[model samples]
Structure formats: C-alpha cells, structure tokens
Target chain A: MTDAAAPTRPIILEAALDAPPDLVWRALTEPELMARWLGASDIEAKVGRCFTVRPDGPVGEAPIACEVLEAEPGRMLSYRWRATAPGEAAALDTVVTWVLEPTAEGGTRLRLVHDGFPVVLQGAIRGQGAGVSTMSAVRRRQAPDLRRRGDGRAKMSSGEVIKWAA
Target chain B: MDLFDFDEAILEADILRALADPTRRAVFEQLARREMSVSELKAGFSVSQPAISQHLAALRGAGLVAERREGRFAYYRAEPQGLAPLIDWIDRYRAFWPERIDRLKDVLKDIKP
Candidate 1:
C-alpha cells in the first residue's frame, strides 16, 4: 500500500543573523570564516568549483563532497552535497542552497534549503534491488496521483527523516 | 584511531541502499512484522524464489536483516540495530546546523567593527 497524502518536502532552516548581508555572505564563502563556523572546508566562492568539508572535532568526521552550482556573492549560494564513503558507487546527492537577504534592521535573513533529499533517498534506495519489473510495476501503480507541491518546502513539517534542531 | 573513529555514514548508506527496492522494502516490512522462512516469504511476492533469496542476501550483507537456520529452513527477521547508524546520521544534522549557526554568530561578532 502507498501513502496517499505523503508530502515530499525538502528540509529548510532559516535564521536571522545580526551581521550585514555582505558579512554573512563572506562567512559563508570564505574558507577561513567558513571553517570557523561550518567545518574545515576548502570552499571557493566561484561557481562550478568542487569542495570538501572535512569533519571538525565531533560535528562531522565524514567528508562531504560538494560541487558548486550557484555562487552569487552577497546574495545566494547553492551546492550539491554528498557524504563520501568507502565502496559505495552511487551516493545520494542533495542540493544545499543558502539565500541571504539584508534586513531593514541591518541583519541578514539566512534561509538554508537542503533540497532533493526525499527524492534522492528514494531513488538511491530503489536502485539497489534486482527486482526491476516488480519495482516498476509498483512505481507505475503509485505514480499517477503523486504530485510535488510548491517549492518542495511545505512537506518538511511532516518528514520523519531529519528532526529539525530546536 | 579509536574504535569510534569509523564513519557511520557508510553503514547508513549501505542500509538505505539495501532497502531501497520496493520488493526488498516489502520483504523487510513483512519480516519486521514477523520472521519468515524463504518459502513463506516467497509465497507473498510474484518474483522468483532466487530473486527473493538475492534480496535477502543483500539485506543480510547490509546488516539490516538477520537469519537463523532451523532444520532445512532459514528464517529471516529485521535487525533493529541495523537502523541505528541511519538514526544517528539524521540526528547529527538535527544538532549540526543550529549549533553551527550559533557559533557563526560569534565569529561574525568577533570580526565585525
């Protein structure tokens, strides 16, 4: 049986930073500043550049392999992230987009969207089995009524995967 | 390195990959509800018996299912501990961003005029 009303939303987290948009953008793009906040990363602010964020201390030790998709200085930054592991051929890729907007009160509203996780998770897992005919039959049975909602953000509230931080 | 130094994402991905198939997921769900032997499990699905065995083997390799042999039959059941790595991976991100953002604030404050 399929879940009829299941929402396929991406995980989105937002925070209002006390810094200006430029400063917030710099913190996100600059390696030194990013390392102080995110993790030990070799991030470049330019588009199409690949980067790696190594685990720092206890936060994350597994390296995150990312490729820059969009890099607009002082505005938005988006990348595809996947955790590298040994012997896994097909790693699930999720998009992480950071949108920075300057607040009238001199703060930056940072909206972070980690998108494509639900689909990616489903796709990655679905590709593992040898029962293609059975899988496709199930997919065909379930595909008609399923529809993606606006911006794929509304479904995060109902997602059981990642519990948002308090 | 210490015993805890191993990356759990590898195991998490393996388990997710193992259960990704619709048939495998159904099989695993059935096993979760009640342990079943190959013949019993094969009866519910339309796939060949060899295919079911292959799916079970993948599940076993991923540590998501455990098997016990009794006489000529092998019974398989879902392994709950096999899910711990995936749970921990998700939990890590739950704590990761909020804490990092807090630290980012400190970084900004220190560098700001």
Candidate 2:
C-alpha cells in the first residue's frame, strides 16, 4: 500500500540470480523455503495473506507484521510491512514489492522496492526505514548478483557496497 | 553486535515514540520546513497552546527538535541528526533482505527441482 498524500521513493535492491524465475519465485513464496533464507517467517504467496517475520540473527529483533498485497506467480510479489520496535506504540508502516523478470541467460532478475517511510526529516535525515524516508531510491542493482564459486558454494552478494546521498 | 544493538534500540524507541502521535508528527512536519514559535505553530494546529508545548517538549526530549529563544519568544525546529537512530535501523534493515536473499540462493541450489 502506498501513501497517496506523499509517495516516497522506495529502497530498491536488485539481483540477477543464476536460478530461473520459477525457482526464485518458490523461494520467495513457500514458507518452508522462505525460512531457510528470509529468517523465520510464515509467509504465503497469496494476496491479503497475513504473516509475521522474526529475523533470526546475532541480535534478536521484534517480529514484523506483514500482509501480502500482490502475489503473481513467477512475476511479482508485494506486501505491506509494519514494524513496531520494542515498547513503541506507533507502527512503522511500509511496503515491499518484488518484481521478477527472466534474463536472456535463463536467470531471474529480481527487484525489491521498499517504501512508505515518514518524510518528516526529509532533507536532513535521508530516507532510512518508514522513519525510512532517506534511503530514498538506493538502487543496489548493478553490483550485486547471485553467483557460484568454483567449489560449488552459492554466493549471494558482492559484499557491502553502497554510495548513499552523494 | 549485542553491545551496540541495545543503545541503538533505545534511540530508535525514543524517535518512534516522539513521532507516534499524528498531531505531533504534524507539528514536526511543520517545524521541519522552517522554524516557528509555539504560538505560530498553534495557529496552524487545532491542539491547545499547552498541548503544543507538550508536543514540542516530547520532540525535544527525543532530540528530534531543537529550541531557540528570540527576545521573549521560544521557537523550535526539527533536528536532522535526531534521525540517526533510524538511519542505523535502516542500514540494518536494508542489509536484512539482501542477506536473506543471499541465503535464498543457497536454498535454491539445494532444492532446485
């Protein structure tokens, strides 16, 4: 869902996956598959489906409330992302839209759009979350992609690389 | 990781609490554009004068606003740096998807049918 009053730009992270669209789509949709990659989430690939994501990492964070907004098999997946930090009343509401395209090499081109951040601190803050206003349109496409190492190990990113707000 | 996470979480909580109120968020949006005295802010908002002061105080406490005094008037404006915690959160957040997506690659390799 977008904020009609103020359409803030989204955080886009694009990647070219070695696998085809169908495989990529499955990983994004199936709960069992999603857990392996997207932390612990009960995500389903149906529009209006509600789910929760509790990212498992070094530090445990609050679970994020999510609802699927658009689910197109092998093509797109979009969801509403609402997060409440521990002890906070207001939820940081945002949207996440994933678009997948098939490449000439039979790989999948995936694009993720995360928007609906508060723009109160527009100029000074630089979009970061649904506080997410300055991470504004941080396009991290060209440098990142899924690749395979000679040892057959899967490498997902090219490491931390971004030049925000130049 | 744990050491810094605690501090960041607290800062993030403060900012979210400060802006959680729609009216206060509105107050912030107004002050962010330009500096204004409490009376000036009151003219645009339906909230009481005392309520405006309270909102300003909340914003100030969160470090989302800075106060200025001119003659007898006190003015407040948005503090850009107050959003640092969020920026930190976003950095962690932005990193989240990619790292997960990265793991997805491995999952796909194993389960590719």
What is the clash count for each candidate, in the order shown?
Answer: 2, 9
Residue-level lDDT of model 2, residues A6-100, one tens digit each, is 32445566777888999899888887888787757899888889998766666646677899999999999999887665665434667888899
What tier of docking accuracy does candidate 2 attain? acceptable
Question: What is the C-alpha DockQ of each candidate?
Answer: 0.16, 0.31
| DockQ value of candidate 2 | 0.31
Please provide, for model 1 over A49-74, each residue's C-alpha lDDT reduced to its tens digit, 9 standing for 90 to 100: 99987647753356778899999899
lDDT tens readout by residue for model 2, B18-51: 8767788788877766789999999999989999
Pairs with backbone N, CA or C atoms under 3 Å apart (clashes), candidate 1: A55-A60, A125-B20
Superposed model 1: Cα runs more than 4 Å off: A1-11, A58-60, A90-93, A115-166, B1-7
Clashing pairs in 2: A117-A130, A118-A130, A126-A134, A127-A133, A127-A134, A127-A135, A128-A132, A128-A134, A129-A132
Give the distance in Å from residue A18's predicted Cα in candidate 2 to where it truly belongs.
1.2
- Tens-digit lDDT string for candidate 1 (B1-113): 11112456566567767766778877876676568999999999999999999999999998878999989878998764565554444334545555677788899998887
What TM-score would every model get versus the actual structure? 0.72, 0.70
For this target, which candidate reaches the highest TM-score against the unseen true structure? 1
